[model samples]
Target chain A: MIDSIARPTAAIRARPVLGAASVVALFVALWMALIWSPPDAAMGNVVRILYVHVANAWLAYLAFVVVFLASIAYLWTKRPAFDAIAVASAEIGVLFTGLTLVLGSIWAKPTWGVWWSWEPRVVTTAVMFAMYVGYLLLRNLSNDLERRATRAAVLGIVLVVDVPIVHLSVTWMNALHQLPTVLRPDLSPTLDPRMLASLVAMTIAFTIVYAYLMTARVDIERRRQARIIEARA
Target chain B: MTIARIWRIAAREALAERGHPDGFVAAITFVATLILVESLAVGPLAAGQPPVAAALFWIAMAFAAILATTRSFDRELEDDAIDAILALPGGRDALYGGKVVALTALLALVALVGGLLSGVLLSLAIALPGHLALVLVAGVLGLPPVIVLFVTLALRLRARGALVPILALPVLVPQLVAATNGTAAAIVGDATGALGWTGLLIAFALVYSVLGLTIVPTALE
Candidate 1:
């Protein structure tokens, strides 16, 4: 099945520019993040990791938002393309969320004096991570493509509801983690200007990487579906 | 008419459960074993350890609910009973509503058994019995509809036995947290906070049941 639908060499050749651009963007972003951004008042160098970590976290949420919309579209239209996008988005979202958790732990070790804490943000993020991992596992459960897509779309829409609830519940619980500095009800910026610029650059770089990976993954899924349909015919 | 139909389906499920008793028996045994293992591990709860007791109770009830839901759905799937029911008018809604009712009753029983055991063997005091009942009622009420929806989603899956808990539990964290906190409040004699937590559980139950009703047909397909 995989061999039958493997991405053609030419298609890969056409996307070399995107691949190169992402690598270049990430490198520049990393250089700016480490060297250009000023060290923190207290956290110093460890705070630099925040640029990449927070960027990946933001991208994970963005990817899942795409998944939620694509899943809804798949249900409304029964389109294979929408399902492919949703699945691809979910896979990428999970990857970024996993990275967020690891980087979070690394940050926590130095800052919170522990490898892990049941701080609301950490707890909710862990649950969100597990939920999407379950979503991916669920997609593999069915052999019937239509059934698989329908069930996964239903779950995708339903599970997205938990994201806000996780946030709400965490807020209700006393959060040991520091409250949000930037993304808040008030959108006033708080960081040093250079640091903010570095963070913004990293965010754009991560988003571009996400877009690139999602497109490639969706193309692979489109080919797989085409091959399957053709083989049946 | 719809209400009557849902009630009839729930009654039939109850009757069938009375005869088979696997889900009920398994849930009871599971909760009992949990309480026993917990007692052995902790070697009797201290007087002021309401939070510990509440956490143990919630964990036991949650796993028991998982067992009961899987068995309850498996019975219907075994004889293609679910397929036959789906072919009938209003079966999707009725089946979901009925499963919610039936599972709620089974879980309430498990909660009672677990709570009683915890009070006795673990030496934990439920200082406010009324609040404790409300906490249990709110928690048990919230689980069934969500669990029913998950069971439906897993019905056609190959590894449903493993998949149901994975899909259901994470979504249930809010409900479980509210319930556990409420139970702890009741144990610790914090009536106001316990009531607030119960309110949260009620809200969760309402939201999930409405959502489950809307999604059951699509998921069953």
Candidate 2:
């Protein structure tokens, strides 16, 4: 099994294809977001940040969903590959979450006139970021591979289950006494068709980029595990 | 039979804590110090407000729960008692339940002390004492399973002191939010709102308890 995983020739062959596709998609996404998309009537050019920001946020969540599923798979199968996939997705998820925060801050500055707000989405995303960072930290606490993976998988499952609850609680925090309709303005304004197209393009591009990163990272993890096994032998 | 075993394990844990009450004392002290410091930072005026007081109260309880639960596992680890426990039939789930029970009890005490202290220091009036107590119970119920699971997962790791909080706090955010808001609602006599938050807290407790039982065996391995 180790040998089969170590020599994933098909995946190896697909890496460059994924890389090239991601690059092409990203360039198209950037062109559409920066130029093709019309500026928002209210916020003007600042709205361009939404294309990338929303994509990053969406993919960050996707990465965590991958982590959650892979974690369950790891636990059920006790397979090293699933563990590798979970950890890689977690790392990428953290990076994307960080990027989402920065981009949101950038967008917030120009639009909301503040770099940060205690809005529900902002608070929820920040907590999500912290939770996964803690996941990575937990992964580092143990030197034993199987043990580490098992523990991290357990945590991954718990944290993923927590995301919706965290969002709900944060939303209710601000809207506790007030009627839902009287609460803060909806963050996503009605988008122009061109803007919608750009948003879709950016999301696809980001997903491709996530796929490319996961493939590379999982390969590295597999090799690392293989090296550990060889050393024991 | 499983229920009996779980109860016995929980009773054993309580007996162990009775023998050495240091962990309980330390946790209460930590909660007191945390509330005092937070109140000092927020100043007398803002700290006295119901919302701020509620937030400070739950925040202290959450951290206190972490301290208490981590020490509970640490005591088990010191004597290699966890392995002995796991050697029994259905031990993993029993152990999880036992820890959750004991920790919940211990944290409840910490919450009581923290609540009284916050009320005095933060000038938080309880308009509906019974509802506030119910909220505290629900909130405390939710914490132990999470604390037990994470602390058990971190038990054998290096830097566990730092790791337990890091791994547990973010997951505890919702509980903190619900407990804080519920306490605020209860303090202001909003029984409806407080009950709503209490329901959320109970749901959180039930979910994590079930999840903890399912995962503890794997976590132990």
Candidate 3:
């Protein structure tokens, strides 16, 4: 039985503020990226894609970190809220991971002269994407709520353990092959100030978007649970 | 005493396999066909082509390991035996340990058969028998825990056959790479270099073993 956890009946009131804030931040980020950031000396305006691509990649990682932590919290506390947060973060994580791959591909076409490369980071990122998708599929296979949460939590823990190992092995494999690193090796020293500023702004803006989506998604889950409990009673 | 009990459970599993032998039979049949198909694809191996042959052998061995794991763990789910075992004192630990031992042995057998089959069918000579065996042994040690955990995880699903490989293979990437590379190194008579990858295989084995022991109980529940 789910205990009636205290929640604001008018939780929708805060969403508009968060939503508007994210919207404003996102617009400012785009303006800064397109207008304020100077053209790249090396690649000209094409480098602007980094503002969107890198920020999305950061948000994807942040989402999975949320999934990982929320999974742990769910397992520890056995609370429905934690499970809601975990699944919400996972859904957002998958969406952003897909976006990151597409944006990276777009960036790669101009920079690397190909739409895709089996670079270590790219390969590991793809693998991670598939693994979390598997996590979602595994969760779907179970019908019971508690059973689903428990099993998904176990899989989440297992998947996170492999992330570091995959990163290490792929890095070593790429080093052995001596392939050119995809990300710039001279990033900090070579980066233009305006570009860095826009990138930083985009990062913050994307983070706010992620947080707002997560909260909104979890709130929806909370209402759904409450309705189910009310019906049962 | 726990170690002894773990061994006894492992021995029971081996004995059970000997009596029924369905999983072993299926794994061997699958490996045989896999090698035959791979041999056709790669075509007459040129001299000093152990890497290609090693890659084929590892792939076949991996599939065979997956098949054997599904059979082994699915049998536990039958007759509600897993529930009974979980009720025993320290049963989860013992069961995990026992399954690891049994699976390691089973996968090692498949690897041996696979390695020899590739050597013969593909005309790939094993220049360093001892070193190649060591690499196979080391890699197979790491293969089973992950496979067993995945097979157990897939038990609750309808698409057990398809889900096991999807969930397990990505995790096995490191072990697969290490095994293939180590086998190639051995075939080139580089015992010292092969040992480096063997050490890597051992590390994977240790990590997966600990992970299985700690998590399998919760997974089983």
Candidate 4:
């Protein structure tokens, strides 16, 4: 059973296609964002950062949703494939989350005049980053694959559930304190057609990149599992 | 029968704690030390302010809860008694419930002692003691389910001591935020605000309690 399950599948065979498509999409997205998009009326060129930042943020969220679903599947079926998917998505989720934070910080320094803020979105994202980092750390605490997968899945579910509450608490905390709004510029800029096109293009590009990364990561996880099983056998 | 079993397990834990009070002692000491150290770091004038004191109080509670939960689970692991406990009918959920009950009671005591100490040491003049007590209770109640769940999940793993906090603390952020703000509001006589935050605390506790119950069985296996 282990031997049969470890055999490479069509999904692995298609990796190059995914990789090529992601590269092409990203180039198109870069062009659209850097040159095709119109500058914002209020913030001008600084608005370009949102194309990448928002895409990263969106993909980070998508990755966690995958983790959540894959975790549930892993728990229900006890399949190594599902576990691999969960862990792969979780790793990518953390990477994108970190990117989101750095990009957010860069965007904030110029816009909010501070590198960080206790604003609801910022605080919530930071907390989530820590939580998923913990998730990744938890994955390494067990030597047994099944044990590690079970524990990671459990934590993954818990962390995802906590996201909304974390967001709510931060928002309410800010609401009560009513931090100085003068520094926070209007985030919802009127999106011109070109700007919308760029944002959409970047989002699509990031999603493809996510797919390419996942395929490679899940392949690595499966190979690692197969090697472990081979050693035991 | 389930409730009785849960109570039995909790009572057993209480008796064990009465006999060996080390966990409770360590937790209290941790709370005291954290509060004192934070107060010193913040300086005398700033530490005495209501908001600062409230934040320090909850921060201490959060760490104290971690210490208490770790020690609680450590006992089960040391005796290798988890398998035996799980062998009993309906033991998994009961054990979780029992631990939550036992730990919540233990933490309530810690909160009482720590709260009074912070009140005096920080020179906080509480306008509403009852509301502040309610916040403390709700906040403490919000803690054990997550701690017990995560600690149990990480119980037999390597690097557990470090892993447990890293796993548990981030989940506890919302509760910590709500509790700290609630404490501040209660101290400053903002009854409505305190109640609002307390509501959030209760919601958090309920959510995690349900989640822990559903997940603990698989986690134990």
Best by TM-score: 4
- TM values, all candidates: 0.93, 0.93, 0.91, 0.94
Docking class of 1: medium
lDDT of each: 0.84, 0.86, 0.80, 0.86
What lDDT score is found at residue A105 in candidate 2?
A: 87
TM-score of 1: 0.93
lDDT of 1 at A220: 81
Model 4, A1-233: lDDT tens digits are 57755777787778899999999999999999999888878788998998998899788888998999998998999989989999999999999999999998998887778898777777778889999998888887677888889988888787787455433454455532233222224554446778878988999999999998998999889988888777778
**Per-residue lDDT for B1-221 in model 2, tens only?**
66777888889889999999878998999999988898889898998989898998888888888888888887888979889999999888888898898888888888888888888877677899999999999999989988889998887889999988888888888889899999999999999999999999999999999888888878886
Angstrom error of the Cα, residue B139, model 2: value is 1.3
Per-prediction count of colliding residue pairs?
0, 0, 0, 0
TM-score of 4: 0.94
Off by over 4 Å in 3: A1-13, A165-190, A223-233, B46-48
lDDT of 2 by residue, A117-220 (tens): 88777877888999999999999878788899999999899888755644355455563211222112574535677888898899999999998999899999
The CA lDDT at A15 in model 3 is 77
Clashing pairs in 1: none
Q: Per candidate, chain B TM-score?
A: 0.95, 0.97, 0.94, 0.98
Candidate 3 lDDT over residue span A1-233, tens digit each:
44454274354457777799899999999999999999988889998998898788778778888888888888788887888788888889889988988998998888888898887767777888888888888877876667778777777878886455434554466432223223344544346677778988999999989878877888887776667556666
Residue A90 in candidate 3 has what lDDT?
Answer: 86
User: TM-score of model 3, chain A?
Assistant: 0.85
The whole-model C-alpha lDDT of candidate 2 against the native structure comes to 0.86
Candidate 4, residue B122: how far the Cα is off, in Å: 1.7
List residue ranges in candidate 2 displaced over 4 A.
A162-190
